[model samples]
Target: MSAKVQWFAKDLLIIGAGFAAAMHIGKLPAAIPILQAELGLSLVQSGLLLSCIQCAGICFALLIGSYVSKLGLKRCVLLGLSLLTLASICAGLTQSVLSLFSMRIIEGFGFLLVTLSGPALIRELAPIQSLPAKMGLWAAYMGGGVGIALITAPMLIQSWSWSVVWFSYALITLSFLIGIAWFIPNTTPSSQAVPLKSLIKLTLQHQPAWLLALIFGTYAGQWFASVGFLPTIYEQNHIAPTLAGLLTASVSIANAVGTFICGLLLQRGLQAKLLVILGFVVLIACALLFYTAKDSLPFMLQYVLVFGFSLFGGLVAGSIFAQALHFAPSPMAISTTVGMILQCSALSQFLLPPSIALLVSSTGTWLWVGVLMSVLSILGIVLTQRLFAIQPKTSA
Candidate 1:
């Protein structure tokens, strides 16, 4: 194979690994009802199940990101996939809530390592000019993996069982683990170990990184809150499981499209700030319309609104991921900066779903979900404005 073809192949393998990792997340929503029925879980517990995959990232992403370079990127990626494969298998065998929850947290640790390392490895492989577009594609890993899992898990669960779904994901992830280990060359940069204090200080002091993290956090929180519980929401509304999975999957795939478009647009010299602001504006509109008008609007229209919300939210995420490469305080701090971003994003994902569940549980309605989304979108907009003010260069 030509060198170019080799690089492209490696990129696909890396992104595919991300997709497999995300399946562990997407597989759960469709299974929530099954879990609740079989495991005797309450609404609060279900919410925790949905968000717990982020627990590792919320607590340790920055720390792990800082040290991954020392550990070797390929090694981390392999180890992460191995953990995921093991966790999925163990989760499948678990007959109780506690064991399943423990496996999910282990899955979270695997997820954090793979995600924190993937982008930096991509940076090492891709040419400078194509970085934005590549990052955009990289950003789509979440939506793509989650979307496919959302659609497929329902069918698999219906035909077989949730354990089958978990085992199937384990097999898929294991295949990727082997592929990555065999095909991807070790691309870890040769660099002296930076002191932990210096890495933390440099990454923390980078103002743009923090703003970007907050922006990503706000967007991720609302997007996950809306999409993660979609299966349960549809169940309550008397929608068929298959149809609900399709709708939720479509919304997530739309998000993947938005992220890809953001990449192409950034490569074409569009401003990151403009794309981010546009995302927030549209998100606010969609959230308000979808949640408030849920009872009155046609189901198709409601789906369209949420689809738009996810799609535009992707733009915000893509922009942030692309910009993170540029905003790192130094070359050595890039992984740390990305870690900080994921850390904040994980924190939001960790907090928002359960909070929304609590609100919905107390109120006996989904009406206030929109209000909460709108508030977050507005915060996103304010943060975007401040981010651009501090670093006003238009080009990505």
Candidate 2:
């Protein structure tokens, strides 16, 4: 019982740290207006700023995963949090766009390190029987972080600048770092002798890794492309900033709830492939209903559809996280599998958001947004089906 409690505590600590890292990602959307006013950024530039954290994930997922394997998960997590704390504090003082850009890249590296290590660490600590449930809960960390950040920023920025919010978040990360150090035991890597090339090759060779990574990319890209712009969209629609923040936060919270539900479903023997397919289908339907002819639709209905998009869309993440644990090529390859998924997810985030912005800029309406997302969702569904067909007949 004591061991189980210790594992549960460790899982919570890792999830908390991940939530804080995600807040660093989430903070930019809330501050877009302030950033535009201060730095004279264009819409596309703001999109780039919002996805700046993906830079590190795109460039270094495999590299960082290899490092985590060598350095030990606990050490890597500590190092990552330290990077976040320092970069966030420095970002609070930056006056130049170039400086802020640099800080964001550093922050990206920090985010990558913590997130990449988190799941593998949880798997290390938790009992095998509890892994599916634990991973499902772990999957909600990013959504919860984003939701909390969106809700809080409007209130914080009313009395203080976005920079002070950055500073305050740094303090938050520092507190998590201290708690993490005290609670989570330092576990050694499974093997120190494997070469990076071998790990990458092994990860790539795993059938489920490719499917999960691609699914994660598609779901994340579509989700972020929509949610990341919600604040700006609501602002343009003449909603109050606080209200927009509240609305966006509510949608994000729905996503977190979806992931939690997915976890429970997985524990109840819900097939992973079915969850992925269902999530994609729901996202497509919701995207169409939410974004089609936006000006003519009932405002309440549009909000409800967007909320549905987030809620059902969350099942994709929970399913992928739970399935990946079972599908990792080996115990040593779990971090590498996660890193690959994150790599693809980040690539989509970096590419899709800018593409979405361009689409809106050229078309002069969000109507086409649904069209784009529908195509992606269809592709996601096709890929998921292919993934299911290729798996062993007895496998979930």
Cand. 1 Cα-lDDT: 0.86
The segments of candidate 2 whose C-alpha lies over 4 angstroms from its true place after superposition are 36-47, 232-236, 360-367, 390-396
Lowest lDDT block of 10, candidate 2: 387-396
The Cα local distance difference test for each model comes to 0.86, 0.84
- Model 2 lDDT tens row, 1-396: 687687788888888898899888878877888889988877878767776778889988977886687788998899899999999999889888887888999999999999989888888777777777778788988888889898877678878899888998899999989988898887876665788788889888888788879888989988877777775667657887667778999998888889889988988888988888899999988888777867777667778888889999889999888777767777677788899899999899778877988998999988898988988889888888887776432222
Query: TM-score for model 1?
Result: 0.92
**Candidate 2 structure, TM-score to reference:** 0.92
TM-scores of the candidates are: 0.92, 0.92
Model 2, 131: alpha-carbon shift in Å? 1.8
In candidate 1, how many clashes are counted? 0
Model 1 over residues 37-110: C-alpha lDDT tens digits? Answer: 99898998987887778889989999998888778888888899999999999999989899999999999999
